[model samples]
Target: MAIHIIDEANRCLNCKKPKCMEGCPVHTPVPHIIQLFKEHQVMDAGRELFENNPMSLICSIVCNHEMQCAGNCVLGKKGSPVHFSSIETYISDMYLDRMKVKTAEQKKQNVAVIGAGPARMTVAVILAQNGYQVTIFEQQDKIGGIKQYGIPEFRLPKTILSRYQKKLLELGIRIRPNTAIGTTLTIEDLLRDGYASVFVGTGVWKARNLGIPGECLANVHFGIDYLANPSAYSLGEKVAVIGMGNAAMDVARTALRNGAHQVTMYARGRRIAASSHEMAYAELDGAEFVFGKAIERITEKGPVFKTSIMDENNRVTGYEEGEEQTEADSTIIAISQGPRNRLIRTTVGLEGSDKGLLIVDENHMTTRKGIFAAGDVVTGSKTVVHAVEAAKKAAEAMMRYMEKEGA
Candidate 1:
C-alpha cells in the first residue's frame, strides 16, 4: 500500500492550477498536500488537511471521489486519476494519533452542538480549538450519526469513528450520548442554561415510506433502519431490495454479507442514482440489478414492480399496464430519508422548511437567532465533505455571534 501511494504521489504533475482542489467540496489543497508528502512532510500534509476539514480522514474514505476530487484530475481524461484518497488516508490516519491539537486561551462561554454527526462533530472540533466550551448531544449510544448508523461497516470502518471520539474527548469536548435534544432537553432549555450558541446538525433520520399497500408488513424493512443494525434482521437467502441509490447499493451488499444468497436491486428508471464506483462495487460483490422497474407495492412474498418505460434521457416516462410480483423472503426499501420534525416541533421560534429541514441563512444561522444549523438538516442528505464545509462556515459565524454578544 505504501509503494502504491508513493507511486501515485510521484505521478502527480503538481499543477499550478489544480483542478482537483476545485473539484473538492472543501477545496482541499491537493497539489500542495501531495508536494508535502513527496518531500517527506507527511505530518505537515495531514495537519493542513485536518485544519481545513476536521473529518479529513473520514472524508478520505467516504467521499465520492469519482464525482469529486479524483474525478476532476487532468490525468483522468486520458487514464486513471492520481488516487488522492489513498494518499490522504495514509497521511490522516498517521497524523490523527500523533498530532497535538492546540486550543486558544480557555474561554468561559459554552456552546451546545445538537447531534454528533459529521456537521456537528466538525463544529465541536473547531469551537473547542478556539477555546470555547463545547458539548455534543447525540441520540444514539455512540457518535458518527449517519457515519455510524446509515453507512455500512465494509465501506467505512466504525473504529475510525471510535478514534475520532477519543480525539474529541482529548480536545475537552463533552459528549452526552443517547441524550436526544428534542424530547426532555429542548433547545430553549440549552439557551437558558448559558449556552451562548447552539448548532443543530441533527441529520435526516426519518425513513421515507413508499405509502403503498403492505408497507407495514413484517417482511418489509426500511433501508435506514436496516443499515443501522443489519444483524438484527433475519433476511433469508432471497432478499429483494427497492431503490437504486448509494444506500440501496449498501443494502444489497450488506445483505449479501449477512447470509443473503440472492440480493437484487430495483430501479425506477434506466439510470441509477448511485455513484458509478458504488454501483461497480455492488456488482462486484455479486448483487444483481434490474432497471426500469417501478415498485407499485410490497407484498408478504416480495415487491410488486411495474415495468417503467423510459425516454431517451433514461427518465421514467410511463409504466406498463400490469405489475409483476417477484419471489423473495424479504423486501427492503432504500428510497432515501427525510429529517425528523422533533426538534422544530419542540423548539419555539425555530422554523423548518416544508420538507422538515431547518431553515438557515447564508451564515448558516437558523431562523432562530444564535442557533445555527448545517449538514443534512439544512441541505438534505449530502456527502461528508459538504457537511464539513458547511459546519466550518457555521462555526466561524457562531464565534462571531458569540464575540459580538460579549459571551
Candidate 2:
C-alpha cells in the first residue's frame, strides 16, 4: 500500500496562499517543500523545512499532520490530500546535511538550558546556531524528555531519537544527562559558573493524583509511570484507564500491546482532550471507549461509576447516580500533569502559577533576572510543536535580553 511518495509529490496543486503552511504552528512552507521534493531536490526541500522546523524528520513522523497541513490540503475537499509527512520524512532523512547550519554570528555567550525536552531542544539548536554556547542538563540518562520516555515505541521508534541524539552531540552542544539540576546544581551555580543566561524548560513532571481508595494498591499506575517504561511495568489483562487525553490514549493503546486482554477507557467530559484521530487509533487497537461516565472511587473489586452529564458548552452539569462497578485487574490514572517545581522552589524570585506553571513576561524572562522559561513549564502540557514554537519565542527574547546586557 506504500506508494512512491516522491512520485506522489507531483500531485500537489500547490496553493498560492498555502493553507497547509498557515495551519502549521511553526509555519513550515509545505507546498514549496513538496515542489522541491517533486523536482528531486531533496537537499533544497530539507533546507526549506530546516528554515522553520529543526526537528523536521521527527515532527513529520509524530505530528498530527492530518489535523494541520494534510487537513487543510485543497485536494482533501474531494480527492486524497498530499502525503506531506511522508515527503518531509524522506527529504529530511535523505539530505540531513542540508539541515545543518554552518554559519552563525559568534554571539559568544554561554546559555544554560535545563531539561532536554522538545522546547529545550529547539532553544539549544537556535542559540547554538546564533553562536551561543548551550549546555543542557537532563535528570535522566536519556534526552528527549517526552519523546524519549512518555511516548510509545510503536508510534515514535527509539531509532529516531538516536539519530537526533547523534545530530545534537555533533552540534557541540554540551549535555549532562543523569544529572538533576536542583540536586546537582542550582540556578545560582550556573550564573556563578559563567553561563550568561538560564532557560528553565524542565516541563511537566508531576502526574495528577487519583484520589480514590485503591490508588495505593499494587496494580494501580499513573500515566507517566505506565508510558515511560511499558516493558518493565507489571501490566494486567483487564486494564481500566480513567482519563481522556493524549497520555490517556497512549496508556490504553500501550496496555493493549502489552498483554492487556481488554482495555476499558473512562472519561467524564463530552470532549476528549486527545485528537479524534488519536482516539480512533486507540479504538482501532481494540481499546474500549467509555465516555460521559467515570470512576467516582476505586475499590479492590473494581471502580464505582457515576454518569456525568455535559452541557452544550461541554461543562459537567451533574453526576447521575448509578450502581455501576466495572471489574478490572488493574487501573491506570491517565489524567493531566503539572510542573514538579523542585528546582523552582529552591530558587528565589521565580514567579509561578497556582497550577505550578512558571510565570514569565512578554520577553519570556522569569521574575528572576537572567532566567527564562517556556514550553510545558510555562503552558502546562502542550503538544511538541507548540513547545517548539514557544521555545523559538523564548530564544528570540533571550537574544534581545543578551543584546541589551551586551553579553
Candidate 3:
C-alpha cells in the first residue's frame, strides 16, 4: 500500500496551473501537497490538508475523484490521473494521531455547536483552537452525524470516525451526546446561558417522500433511515430500490451484502443520477438497473412503475399509458432529503426556504444575528468538502462577531 501511494505521488507533474485543485470543491492544494509528499515533508502535507479542510481524510476516501480532482487532471485525458486520494489518505491518517498543537490562551467566552457532522466538527475545532470554550450538542449517541450514521462501513470504516472523536476531545472540544438543541435546550437557551456564538450544522435527515400510495407500508423504507441502521430491517431476497442517485446505489449494494439475492434499481428518467463510478460498483455487486420507469405508486407486491416517455434529449417528457408492477420482498426510496425544522419551529426569527432549508448569508450567518449555519441544513445535501469550505468561512465570521460584540 505504501509503495503504491509513493508511485502515485511520483506520477504528479506538479502543474504550474493545477486543474486538480481548481476542480476540488474546497480547492485542496493538490500539487503543493504532492510536492511536500515527494520532498519527505509528510507531516507538512497533512497539516496543509487539514488546515485547508478539517475532514481531509474522510473526503479523501469518500469524495467522487472521477468528478473532482482526478477527473480534471491533465494526464487523465490520456492515461490514469495521479491518485492523489491514496497519497492524502496515507498522510492524513498518519498525521491525525500525531497531531498536537499549542492553542491560543483560553478565553471565557463560550461557543455552542449544534450537530457533530463535518461542518459542525470543523467549526468546533477552529473555535477550540482559537481559545473559545467549544461544546458540541449532538442528537445522536455519538459524533460524525452523517459520516457515522448515513455512510456504510464498507465504504468508510467506522473506526476512522472513532479516531476523529478522540482528536476532537484532544483539542479541548466538549461533546454532549444525545442532546438535541431544539428539543429541551433551544438556541435561545444557549444564548441565555452566555454562549457568545451558536453554529447550527444539523444536516438534512428528513426523507422526501414520493407522496404515492402505499408509501407508509411496513415493507417499504427510506434510504437514509435504512442506511443509518441496515441491520435493523430485514429486507428479503428480492429487494427493489427506487431512484438512481448515489444513495440508491448504496442502498442496492448494502441490500445485496445483507442477504438480498436480487437487488434492482428503478430510475424515473432514461439517464441515472448516480455517478458512473458508484453505478459501476453497484453493478459489480450484482445489482441491476432499470431506467425509463416512472413510479406511479407502490403496492404489496412491489413498486408499480409506468413507462416514462422520453424526448430527444432523454429527458422524462411524461408517463406513458400502461403500468407494470414488479415482484419484490421489499422496497426502499432513495429520492433525496430535506432539512428538519425542529430548530426553525422552536426558534423565533430563524428563516428557512420553501424546501425547509435554513437561510444563510455570504458569511454563513443566518437570519438571526448571532446564529450561523452551513452544510446540508443551509445549502441542501452536498459533499463533505463543500461543508468544510462553508464551515471555515462561518467560523471566521463567528469569531469576528463575538470579538466585535465583546462577548
What do the candidate models score in CA lDDT, each in turn? Answer: 0.94, 0.85, 0.92
Off by over 4 Å in 1: none
Candidate 2: residue pairs that collide: none
As for TM-score, the candidate ahead, 2 or 3, is 3
Model 3: worst 10 consecutive residues (lDDT sum): 95-104
* TM-score per candidate, chains pooled: 0.99, 0.94, 0.98
**In model 1, how large is the Cα lDDT of residue 350?**
92
Tens digits of per-residue lDDT for model 1, 1-407: 99999999999999989999999999999999999999999999999999999999999999999899899999999999999999999999999999897999989899999999999999999999999999999989999999999899999999999999999999999999989999998999999999999999999999999899989999999999999999999999999989899999999999999999999998888777799999999999999999989888888889998999888888888999998989999999999899999889998889998999999999999889999999999999888999999999999999999999984
lDDT of 3 by residue, 1-407 (tens): 99999899889998999999999999999999989998999999999998888899999999989989999999999999998999999999999888876578998889999999999999998988899999999999989999999888899999999999998988899999999989999999999999988999999999999999989998999999999999999999999999998888989999998999999999888787688999999999999989899888898899998998899999888888988989999999999999999999999999999999999998889999899999999989888888998999999999999998984
Question: What is the lDDT, from 0 to 100, of the residue 120 in candidate 1?
Answer: 95
Between candidates 2 and 3, the one scoring higher on lDDT is 3
What is every candidate's alpha-carbon RMSD to the true fold?
Answer: 0.8, 2.0, 1.0
In order of lDDT, best first, we have 1, 3, 2
- Candidate 2 Cα misplacement greater than 4 A, ranges: 97-107, 310-315
lDDT of model number 3: 0.92
